[model samples]
Target chain A: MAPALFHLFALLTVASAVGVVATKNAVTAAMSFLLCLVGVAGLFVQLDAYLLAFLLLLVYAGAVVALFLFIIMLLDTQGQKNWGFKKFPIFVSLIALGLLLTGLGTFVTRGQLDAPNPNAAGGVGAALKPYAYQLFTTYLLPVQVMGFLLLIAMLGVIVLSKKIDGVEDVK
Target chain B: MIDFWSNLHPVVQGLIKGLAVIMVIFPLAGACSLAERKVSAWMQGRPGPNRAIVPWIAWIPFVGTFLQRLGVFHLMADGAKFLFKEEPVPGHVNKVYFALAPAIAMMPALTTITVVPFGAYFNAAGDAIPLVLANVDVGLLAVFAVSSLGVYSLILAGWASNSKYPFLGSVRASAQLISYELSMTLSVIPVFLWINAPGAPGTMSLAKVVEFQSLPGFWGGTWFVFLMPLSAFIFLVSLFAETNRQPFDMPESEADLVGGFHTEYGAFKWSLFFVAEYSHMLVGSGVFTLLFFGGWNPLPWISLADLVGWLHHATHAAWTIHPLFVGVLSLGIFLGKVLTLIFIFMWVRWTVPRFRYDQVMKLGWQKLLPLAIANLILYALAIAFIQKSAS
Candidate 1:
C-alpha cells in the first residue's frame, strides 16, 4: 500500500513539475505548479511526515501558489507570447544537463538507498517533537535570523508597493 | 456479525464512512439553504418557501398541510431546479478551470469532515471507538490543511470566468481567506496548549480534545470555551470569516460583486459552491463545538466513566456500555449542538449587515490577529505559572 501510494504521488509530482515548465499560459503553469506541490505533499504523507505534509499543503498549496495565481491574474498575461524551444542557449542547457547528471551520480553513489521507515520509531506527534525541540533550542539563533530576514523582505515589499504622492509622474 | 464487521479492512471501513458522511452532509447543506430562506423570511416579516410539496403528500389532511407549510419538500425542488437548469459556459472563459473549480471547491469541505469526532463509544473489550471517519493523529491540522485548498477553487473560478466581477471577487476571497487563516490557526494554539499534558507534545486530535473536556479530574474537566472564552470568540469570528458567512462575506456580496467569484456559474455548478460554503459552515460549527463545547458529553466532567457503574449493573456485561446505545445518544448530543450553532449562524446572517470590504480586512488583520496572539501569550503565561506553582 505504501509503495503504491509513493509511486503514484511521485509520478504525479514529476508529471506536474514538467507541466509547470511546459505550459504556455501563466495561469496554467501556476495550476500545474500547485498540482506538483500537492503531489509532493502526498509523498510526504506517504512517508509519515504528516506535519510536513500538512504544512506543505497549508503554506504552499493554500497561500504561496494562490499568491502566484493572483500575481499572474493581476498582470493580464492572456496576450503574452509563449517561449519557444529555438530561443534556448545550448551552452546553458549543457551546463544544466551536466549538473543534473553529476548530482544524480553523487546521490546514487553516496546516499543511503534503503533508510529504515522513520515512522517505525514513533507516532506522528513524537516524530515532530524532537524536530521542533531542535529548531527552538539548538537552532534558535538561525531560526531567529531567518525570521528577521523575512521581516526585512516584508518591509521591502511594503516600501516598493507604497504609493507616493509625486511618484507616478517621476517614474 | 459484530466479529465479522470488526474484521473488515480499514480502507473499506473508511469508504463506507465517507459515503455515509456525504449522504448526511449533502442533505444537511440543502436543509441549511432551506433554513436560510425560512429564517430570513421570519426576520423580514414575510412568508417563506411554504409552497413546494409533493402532490401526493399535499393531498393528505392536516399533517400534509403542516408539512407543506413547513416547506419540507423545497430541498427536492431546489435540487431538481439546479440539475435541470441550463449550464452555459461563456465563450471567453478558460474552459478547463471553469469546469474544474466547483469540484475543487467541494472536495475540501467534504474531506475535512473525516477527522471531526461526532462521538465516541466503548466496545465490549472496553476500548473507546471514536465516531470519526479518518482518525489521523494530526486531526485538526488535517482539517485545516484540506480546507485551505478550498480557496484555490474560488480563485480559479474567479480567474477562469475572465470577467471583471468574478476577478475582483476571487481576489477579495484570496485576501480574506489568507488574512483570517493566520488568526484562525493562532487562536486554536491556546486551546491545545492548555489541553496538553505536562512535558508532552500538544495534541491536535479532535477526540483527544473531547476526552480532555469530558474527563472528571484535571482543572475539573472544564470545556475550553469557558476556560478560554477569548480564544473561542476569536476562533468563532475567524470561523465566520473563514466560511465566508455574513458581514465578512464581502467576496460574494451580491449587491457589490453580483455573486462574486461565481458570477458566471449557474445551475449545478453554482449550487456546488453553495454546498461547499454551507459544508464549511457545518464543519466549522462542529469543530467549534468540539473544541469549546463538551463534545458528545451531556455535560463537562461527565464521561461514559460515570455511566459505566450503572451500565455494567443493568446489563451484567463488561465495564463498557453497548456501542450502539452509546453511539446513538452521543450522536444525538453532538448533532443537537451542531444544529444550535447552525441556527446561530442563520440568525447572525439575518441580524448583521454586511461589513464593508475595508472593515472586513481591518477586523481580520488588525483586530482578530492581535487579539488571537495576545490570547495565546496570555494562556501560555498562565499555564507556565500554574505549572511552577504545582511543582
Candidate 2:
C-alpha cells in the first residue's frame, strides 16, 4: 500500500513539475506549481518527516504560491500575451528535455536505491530533541550572533525601503 | 457521528484529525484577532470591544455569565459577518486564481500541525495510540519544508491579482522568504549536530532527545533553554519573521503594501489569509516548544521514568489509568506550553512596531545569515573539543 501510494505521488509530482516549466500561460504554470508542491509534501510524508511535509505545505503552498498569484494578477499581462516560443528557444527546450530524460533513465537502470537504515540512532525524530539540546549548549555563540545578524538585517531593510534623496518613485 | 463512522478509512481518519485541529485552531485564531485588538487598545489606553455584546443574553446576564458567553460568541459573529459580506473580485484579475489563492494560503497552515506531538502514545489491547497524527522520525524537517511553501501563496496572490501594490508585496515576500529561509535552516543545523554528535551512531529522534535530557541531576534533566539561550532566542526571533509576524511583517504592512499581497482579496478569501497566518503561528509555536522547551515535559527537568515511578507509588493498587493516560498528561503539559508561547506571540505582535520592508530584508541577509553560519561553525568546534576531552 505504501509503495503504491509513493509511486502515485511521485508520478504526479514529477509530471506536474514538468507541466509547471512547460506551460505557456503564466497562470496555468502557477497552478501547476501548486500541484507540484502538494506532490512534494506527499513525498515528505512518505519519508516519515511529517513536520517537513507540513512545513512544505504551510510555507510554500500557502504563502509562496499566493505571492505568485498576486504578482500574476498585478501584472495584468493578458493584453500583452506572447504565446509561442521562438524557434531557437524551442530547439533549446527540446535539447534540455532530452538530456533530462537520459539522466533519469540512467538513474532508473542503475537500481542502486538503498533501503533506510533502521539501526541508525536518531531515526526520524532524532534531530528534533537534540537540536534543542545542542542549540543551548554547544552552539550558543553562533546563536547569539544570528540574533545580531537579524537585528542588522532588519535595520538594513528599513534603510533601503526608505525614501532617499534623488531616488525616483517607481509608481 | 454516523457520518464519521462511514468515513473511517486511514486517509479519512487523517483528514478528520486534520480538520478537527483546524476547527479548534480557527476559533483560536479569531480570538487572536480579538486579542490583538484588545492588546493594541490597551497599549494605546482605549477600550476595545466592550460594547460588542451578545444581543439578548448580555441584557439578562450577570458579569461572569455575560462575559463568558460573549467571549464564546464573539468569534461566531465575526465569522458570520465575513461569510455574509459580499465577496468582491476586482476587475482585470484572473478570477480562478484569485478565488483559489486564499485556499492555497490556508490549506498548508492547517495541515502543518499534524506532526506536532502534543503528547506521547500508549497501547491498549495491543493497539497503539499515537498522540500525533503521524509520528515520523523526520518530523522537524517536515515542519520546515511545509512552512517554506507558505511564501508561495503570497507570491501567487500578488501575481494573479494584477495590481501594483499586490505585485510589490509579492516581490518583497519572495525576496524576504528566500533570504530568511537560508538563515532559518542554518540556525537549526547546530541543533541537529548536537542531537547527533559523533559516535551517537544514529540520527537524533525527537523522543530520544527529550529522553536524554530527562536524567536525574539538576543540570542533567532540564530544558535546553538554559544551555543554549542564544540559539533559543535566535530561533524565536527568526520564527517570528519566518511566520511573517509583526516587527517582521513587512509583506502585509497596511501603510506600505495597502493590504500587502492580498490587497485585492476580500470576503471569505481574505479571511483565509488570516487563517493561514494564525495557523502558521500556532504550528511554529508548537515546534518551538517541542524543540527548545522540552516538549510535553512538565517541570522542565521531569522525565517519563520519574513520573512512572511516582505514579506507581501514588496509585498503588487501582492504577487503572493506563500508561496512555500518562502520555496524555504529558501532552497536556506540552499543549499548555504551546498555548503560552502563542500568547506571547500575540503579546509581541501588539507591542512592537512593524519593521520597514528594506529593514526586514537586510536583517535576514546581512545579519541572521552570517550569524547562523558562525553558530554552526562554533557548534562544530565545540562538539569536537568535547569529544576529545571526554575520550
Candidate 3:
C-alpha cells in the first residue's frame, strides 16, 4: 500500500510539473503548480512528516498559489501567448537539464549517503518536540538567517509596491 | 463478520467511516437550509415553506401540521427541485472550471468533518475518549489546510463565470478568507499553549484540548471561553468570516454583487455551494464548541465523566456505564451546542446588515489581526509564568 501510494504521488508530481510547463494558459499553469505542491506534500506525509506536509499545503497551496492565481487573473496575461521562450534560453535550459540528469545518474549509480543512526537525538522528520528543538538548537543560525532573508524580502516588496506622492522627502 | 471487519484495511475502515459521516452531514446541511427559512420567517412574523406536503402524510393531524410548520417537507422539495432543475452551462464561461467549482467547494468541507471528533465513550478504566474518524496529531491544522482550499472553488467560480459581478465577488472572497485566516490561526495558538504545558506531549489535537478542559480543577475544568474569552471572540469572528456567513458574506453580497462568487451557478451546482457553506458552518461551530464550550461536556465545570457519574448515581443501573449510552449522550450534547451556534449564525444573519467589502477587509486586517496578536502575547506570558512558577 505504501509503495503504491508513493508511486501514485510521484507520478502525480511529475505529471503536474510537466503540465505547469506544457499548459499555455497562465491560470492553468498556476493550478498545475498547485497540484504539484499537493503531490509533494503527499510524499512528505508518507515519510511520517505530517507537520511538514500540512505546513507545505497551508503556506504554499493555500496562500501562495491562490495569490499567484489572483495576479494571473488580474493581469489577464493570456494576450502574451506569442511571448514564447527565445532560442538562447532554450539552449541554456537544455544544458541545465543535461547537468540535472547527469547529477541524478551519479546519485543513483554511485553516490552513497552516510546511513543515519535510527537512534539519533533529533532529525528533520521527528515528532514535533525533537523537530522543533533541532530547529532552535542545532539549526538555529541557519533558521535565523532564513528569517532575516524573509524579512528583507518582505521590506523590499513593500518598498517597491507602495506608491509615494512626494519623492525625495527624506533629508 | 466481526473478524472480517477487523481484518479490513485501515484505509478501507476509514473510507467506510467517512462515507457514513458524510451521509449524515449532507442531510443535516439540507435541514439547515430549511431551518434558515423557518427561522427567517419566524423573525419576520410569517409562515415559511409550510405549504409543501405529501398528500397522504398530511392526513395525520397535529403531527403533520407540526412537521409542515417546521418545513420538513420543504427539504425534500428543495432536494428534488435542485436535482431535476436545468443545469445551464453558459456559452462564454470557462467550461472545465465552471463545472469543477461546486465539486471543489464540497471536497474540503466534507474532508474537515473527519478530523473533528463529534462524540466520546468512557473506556473501562473510565477515561472519556473521543470517537473521531481520523485522530491525527495535527487535527486543527489539517482542517485549516483543507478548508483554506475552499477559497479556490469561489475563485474558480468567479473567474470562470466570465462576468463583472462574479469576478468582483470571487476576488473579495479570496481576499477576505485569506485575511481572516491569519487572525484565526493566531487566536488558537494561546489555546494550544495552555493545553500543551511544559512537559505535555505537545499535541495540537482538538480532543486533547477538550481533555484539558475536562481535567478536575478551577483552571482545568473551566472551558476556554471562560478562561480565554478574547481568543474565543477572535476565533468566532474569524469563523464567521471564513464560513462566509453574514455580515461577512462579501463573496455573495447579494444586494450589491447579485449572489457574489456563485452568481453564474444554478441548479444542483448552486445547491452544492450552499451545502458546502453550511458544512463549513457546522464544522466551524463544532470546532468553536470544542475549543470554548467544553465539547461533548454538558457544561463548563461539569465534565462528561461527571455527568456519567451523576447518571449512574441517579439510576444505579448497569446500563448507565454502557458505551452506547454515553456515546449517544455525548453526541447529543455536542450536536446541541452546534445547533445552538448555527441558530446564532442565522440569528445574526437576520439581525446584522451585510458589511461593505472595504469594511470587511479593514476589520479582518486592521482590527482583528492586531487584537488577536495582543491576546496571544498576553496568554503566552501568563501561561509561561504560571507553568514556570508552579514547576
Candidate 4:
C-alpha cells in the first residue's frame, strides 16, 4: 500500500513539475510549482526522510513559493499575453526526455535497483549526519564561499530593487 | 500487548499519534486563551470570565461543581460559542483560499509535534517503547521544517482577503518570516554540528542528543543553554517573530490591521487561526525546551535515572513498574518544561509592546541576522580553539 501510494505521489509530483515549466501564466506556473514541491516532500516522507520532506515543504513550498507569489503580485502581469514557444522547443524537450530515459535504462540494466545494504553503519538518519560534518570540517572552505555567494546575491537584489537616481542606461 | 501495538505500521502509528496531538492541542489552545484572559485581567486589576457557566450542566449541583472545577464547562462553552458565531464573509475576498488559509496554517503546526521526543525509551514487554509519535532520527529537522511552513497561513490569509490591510499584513509577514528563517537555520546549524561533533557514525538523533547532554558531572549535564547561550537567544527571538507573537506581531496589530490576515474570517475559521497561533507557540516553546533546556531533565544537574534511583533507595524496596509508567513520567517532565516556557511566552506577550512594521523588519534583517552570523563564527572559532588545546 505504501509503495503504491508513493509511486502515485511521485508520478503526480513529476507531472506537476513539468506543468510548472510548461505553463504560460506566471501565477498558474507558481501554483503548479508549489504542487510539485509538496509532491516531492511527500516522496521524501515515503523514503523515511521525514526531515528532508519537512524542509522541502517548509523552505521551498513555504518561503520560496511565497517569494514567487510576492513577485507575481508585484509584477501584476495580466491579460495572458501569448508567449508562443520558441521554434524547436518540442525538439529540445524530446532530446532532454530521451537523455533522461537513457540514464534510467542504464541504471536499471546495471542492476543498481537492488535493496540497500542493511549492514551499513548509519541508516537514513546517519547518512545525513555527514552533511553537518562536511559543512564544518572538510567542506568548510566551500561553506564559507557559499556564504559569500549569498551575501553577493543579497547585495545584488537590493541594488536591483532599489530606485536609482536619474540614470537609465540604454542598451 | 505492547509488542503487538509496536508491530503496527509506522504510518498508521503516526496518524494515531497525530490525532492524539490534535486532541490534546485543541484544549491546550483553549486553556491558553483562558489563561491569557485571566492573566491580562489580573494585570489590569479586573475579574475575567468568572460568570460564564455551562447552562445544561450547571443545574446538576455536584456534577456541575466538578465540571466547573475541572474547567470542562469552559471548554464546551468556548466550542459552542465558536459553532454558533456567524462566519462573516466580506465582499472582496477569494472565499476559497480565505477559508482554506486557517487550516493550512494549523495543519503543519499540529503535525510538527508528532516528531518531538517527549520521553526516554522504556522496556515495554521486552520491546523498546519510545515516548513520541515518530522516533525518526531527523526529528529536530522535521520539527524545523514543519514550523517553517506556518508562515503560509498568514501569507495566504492576507492575500485571499483582498483587503489592503490584510495584503500589507501578509506582505510584512512573508518578508519577516523569510528574513528570520535564514538566521534561525544558520544559528541552529552550530548546535547540530556540536551534537554530531564526536565524528559519530550515526546522525544526532534527538534521543541520543538528550542522552549526551544528560551525562554525569556539572559541565557534562549542562544544557546547550550554557555552551551556546547566544544561539539560544537568537533562536528564541527568531521563534517569537516566526510565530508572530508580541513585539514582532506587526501583521496582526489591531491598531493597524483591524484584524490582520483573518480580518474577513469569523467564528470557527477565526478560531482555527487562534488555534494555529497558540499551537505554534506551544510547539515553538517545546522545541526551545528540547534544544536549549535539558529535555525531561528534572533539575539542571540531575538525570531522570538518578532521580528514579533515589526514589527506589528512599522507599527501600525493589521498585517495579510497567514501562508505560516510566514513559508517562518522562512525558510529564517534558510537558512541565514546555508549560513553564509557555507561561513565559504569555508573560512576555502582555509585558511587551508591538513593534512598528518597519522596526520589526529592521530588527530581523539588520539586527538579528548579523548577530546570528557573528554567533556562528564565534562558535566555530571557539570549537576550533578548544579542539586545538585538547589535542
Candidate 5:
C-alpha cells in the first residue's frame, strides 16, 4: 500500500514537473509548479515526515505559488504561445542535463539513501521535541545564520521595492 | 469489543465520519445563515424572515405556527431557490475554472473539520475515546495548511469571471487572507506552548489541548484564555479576517466590489461560497473554543468524565448508558460553545463597520503581527523562567 502510494506521488511529481515547461501560459505553468510541490510534499508524507509535508504546503503551495499566480494575473502576461524548440537555449539546457545526469549517477553508484528511522521517536508530539532540541543545540549556529540570511534578503527586497520620497528613477 | 471496533478498516471509518460531518455541517451552515439574518434583524429593531412559510405546512397543528413563526421552512426554500435559479456562463469567462472555484472554496472548509475534536467519550469498558475524525499529531497545522489553499478559490473565481469587480475582489482576498494568516498562526503558538507537556514535543491535536486545559489548576481548570488573553484576542481578530467576515470583509465590500469574487456567480455556485464561509466560521469557532474555552467541559470547575462516572454509579444502570449519556452531553456542550462563538461573530459583524482596505492592511501587517510576536516572546521568557525556578 505504501509503496503504491509512493509510486503515485512520484508519478505525479514527474508529470507536473513536465507540465511546468510544457504549458504555454505563465499562469498555467505556475499552477503546474504548485502541483509539483504538492506531489513532492505527498512523497514526504509517505516518508513519514508530516512536518515537512505541511511546511511544503504552507510555504510553497500556500504562499510562494499563490504569489506567483498573483503576479502573473496582475501583469496579465498571457498570449505567449511560442513553444518552438528553436527558442530553447541549448547552453543552459546542456548544463541542466549534465547536472541531472551527475546527480542520478551519484545516486545509482555511491549514494546511500538512508531509510527513515522507524524506531525514531514516533508520532507528531514526540518528533517535535528532538526536532526542536537538535535545531537549538546541534544546528543552532546554522539556524541563526539562516535567520540572518532571511532577514538580509527581506531587507534587500524592501530597499529595492520601496520608493524614496526624492527618488525619481525608482520605477 | 473495543478491539473489535478499533479493528475496523480505517477507510471505512473515514468514510463514515466524512458522511456524518457533511450531514451536520450542511444544515449547520444553513441554520447559521438564518441565525445571522434574524440576529441582525433583532439588533436593527426589525422582524427578520418570519413570513417565508409554506402554506400547507402552516396549516398543520401547534408545531406548524411555531415552525412558521421561527421561519424554519425558509431554509428549505432557500435551498430549493439556489438549486433552481438560473445559472449563466458568460462569454468571456473561463468556464473550467469558474466551475471549479466553488468546489475548491468548499473543500478546505470541510477538510479542516476532520481534525476538530468535538467531544470525548468512554466506551462500555470505560476507556476514554476521543470524538474526532482524524487525530493526526499536526492537526492544527494541517487545518491551517489546508484552509490557506481556500484563497485559490476566490482568486480563481475572480479571474475566471473576467470581470473588474471580481478581479479586484480576488486580489483583495489574496492579500487579506495572506496577511492575517501570519498573525493567526503566530497567535496560536503561545496557547500550544502553555498546553505542551514540560518535556514533550508538544501537541497540535485539539483533543490534547482540551485535555491540558481540563487538568486541575489554579482555577480548577486552566483555560489558555486565562493565561494568554493576548493570544486569544489576536486569534479571534485574525479568525474574523481569515473567514472574511465584517469588519474585515474588504475582499467583498459590497459598496466597492459588487459581490467580490462571486460577482458573476448565482444560484448553487454562489451559495457554495456562503456555505464555505459559514463552515469556516464554524470550524474557526470550534478551534477557538478548544484552544481557549474549556472544550466539552460543562462548567469551569466541572470535568465531564468524573461527572459521568458519578452519574453511572448513582444510576446503577447498564454500563453502556453512562458513556452514551456522557457522549451526548459533551457533544451538546461542545456545540453550545461553538454556537455562542458563532453568535459573537454575527454580533460583531453587525456592530463594526467595514475597514478600508488600507486600514485592514495596516492592522494585519503592522498592528497584529507585532503584537503576536511580542506575545510569543513574552510567553517564551515566562515559561523559561518558571521552568528554571522549578528546577
Candidate 6:
C-alpha cells in the first residue's frame, strides 16, 4: 500500500508539472504550480519526512503560489494577447533547457535514487527532535550563512526602494 | 461510549469521527450566522429575526413565542432558502474557478479540525487523555498550513468575478492575509518555546501544550495567557485579520468594496462562503483556547484532574470517575470556552468600527509584526536564562 501510494504521488507530481508548463492562462498555470507543489509534499510525506512536507506546503503552496497568482492577475489582464515566441528568447530558452537536462542527469546518477522501504525508519527529517537537534548542532554554520545572506538581500531591497523617496520630484 | 468507540476498526473509526465533527461544525457554523444578527441587534437596541416559527410548535403558546423571539426557526428558513435559491452564473465570469472557490473555501475550514484536540477524558488513575481526531506530532503546524490554503478560495473568487470590485477585493485579501500571517506565526513561537524547553522530547502537538498547563504546580498550572500576555495579544490581533473578521475584514468589507469578493456571488454559493468563514472562526477560537486558555481545565491553577478530584471528595461519588461523565464534563468546559470566545468575536465586530484599508495595512506591518518579533526575542532570552540557571 505504501509503495502504491508513493507511485500515485509521483504520477501526480509529474502530471501536474506538465500541466504547469502546458496551461495558457497565467492564473491557471499558477494553480497548476500549486498542485505540483502539493504532489511533491505528498511524496515527502510518503518518504516520512513530515517536516519537509509541511514546510514545502506551507511555504510554496501557501505563500509563494498566492504571490504568483497575485502578480499574474495584476499583469495579465483578460483578453490580452499571449506573447509570441520571439527569436532571441527562443534561442536563450533552448540553452537554459539544455543546461537543466544536463543538471538533472548528473543529480539523478549521484543522488539517493533508491527509495527506502515503507517500514524503514526515516532519516533525520522524520521527527522534530533529531531534525531540530541536527539543525542547531551540525548544520548551524550553514543555517547562519543562509540567514545572513537573506538579511543582506532584504537590506539591499530596502535600500533600493527607499533611495527613490528623496530623489522624487512629486512630494 | 469508550468501549463502543474502541471496538470499531481504525479506518472506520476515523471515518465516523470525521463525519461526526463535520456534522456538528456545519450546523454550528450556520447558527453562528443567526447569532451574529441577534448579537448586532441586541447591541443596537432592536429585536432581530424574531418572526419565523414552525406551525405545529405554535400550539405550545409561551414556548413557541419564546423560540420565535429567539429567532431559532430562522436557522431552518435560511438553510432552506439558500438551498432553493437560484445559483446565477455571471455572463463574463470564469465558470470553473467561480464554482470551485466556495468548495475550496470549505476544505481547509473543516480539515483543520482534525488536528485540534478539543476535550479530554480521564482514566481511573486520573490521567487526562486528549480526545482528537488525529493527534499528529506536527499538530499546530498542520493546522496553519492547511488553513493558509483558504486564501486561495478568496483570491479565486475575486479573480474569477472578472470585474472591478471583486478583483480589487481579491487584491486586498492577498496582501492582508500574507502580511498578518507573519505576525500570527511569530507570536505562537513563544508559547512553543516555553513548552518545548531543553531536555524535553520535541513535539508540536497542541495537546501537549494543554498538558503542560495542567501540571500540579503554580507556574505549571498557570495558563500561557497570563505568562505571555503580549504574545497572546499579538496572536489575537493576527487571528482576527487571518480569519477576516471585522475591523480587519478588508476582503469583504461591504461598505466600500460593495460586498467585496462575493459581490458577484449569491444564494448557496454566498452561504457557503459565510459558513466557511464561521468555520474558520470556530477553529481559530479552538486553537486559541488550547494555546492560551486551559484546554479542558476549568479554571486558572485548577487542572481537569483537580476538578474531578474535588468533585469526588465533595460528593463522595463513585460515578465521578466514569469516563463518559468525565468526557462530557470536559467537553462541555472546552466547548463553553470556545463559544465564549466566538461571542467575544461577535461582540467586537459590532462595537468596533472597521479600520481604513491603509490603517489596516500599517497596523499589520508596522505595529503588529514588529511587536510579535520583539515578543518572540524577549521570550527566547527569558526562557534561555531560566533553563541555563536551572542547570
lDDT of 6 by residue, B253-363 (tens): 899999899999999999999999999999999999999998989999999988988898999988887887888899899999999999999999998999999999999
Residue pairs in collision within model 3: none
Q: For model 1, state the Cα shift of residue B362 in Å.
A: 1.1
lDDT of each: 0.87, 0.73, 0.91, 0.78, 0.86, 0.91
| Tens digit of per-residue lDDT, candidate 5, span B68-162 | 77878888889999999899778899898899999999998998898888988877676557788878888888888888989889888998899
Indicate the worst ten consecutive residues by lDDT in candidate 5 chain A.
A118-127
Best candidate, TM-score: 3
Ten-residue region with minimum lDDT total, candidate 1 chain B: B301-310
Question: Residue A69 deviation, candidate 5, in Å?
Answer: 1.1
Candidate RMSDs in order: 2.8, 7.4, 2.2, 3.9, 2.6, 2.8
Every model's TM-score on chain B: 0.94, 0.88, 0.98, 0.91, 0.94, 0.98
Better of 2 and 5 by TM-score: 5
Report lDDT (Cα) of residue B357, candidate 1.
94
Q: What TM-score does chain A of each model score against the native chain A?
A: 0.81, 0.65, 0.85, 0.73, 0.81, 0.75
Q: What lDDT is obtained when candidate 1 is compared to the true structure?
A: 0.87
What are the models' TM-scores? Answer: 0.93, 0.77, 0.96, 0.86, 0.93, 0.93
Q: On TM-score, who's better, 3 or 5? A: 3
Q: Which 10 residues in a row give candidate 1 chain A its minimum summed lDDT? A: A119-128
What DockQ, on C-alphas, does every prediction get?
Answer: 0.60, 0.31, 0.60, 0.53, 0.62, 0.66
Write candidate 2's Cα lDDT for A1-171 as tens digits: 799999999998999998998877877887788889889878877776655566676567755675675567557555676656699999998999999999888879987666667654245433445445556877889999999999999899898799989989767
Ranking by lDDT: 3, 6, 1, 5, 4, 2
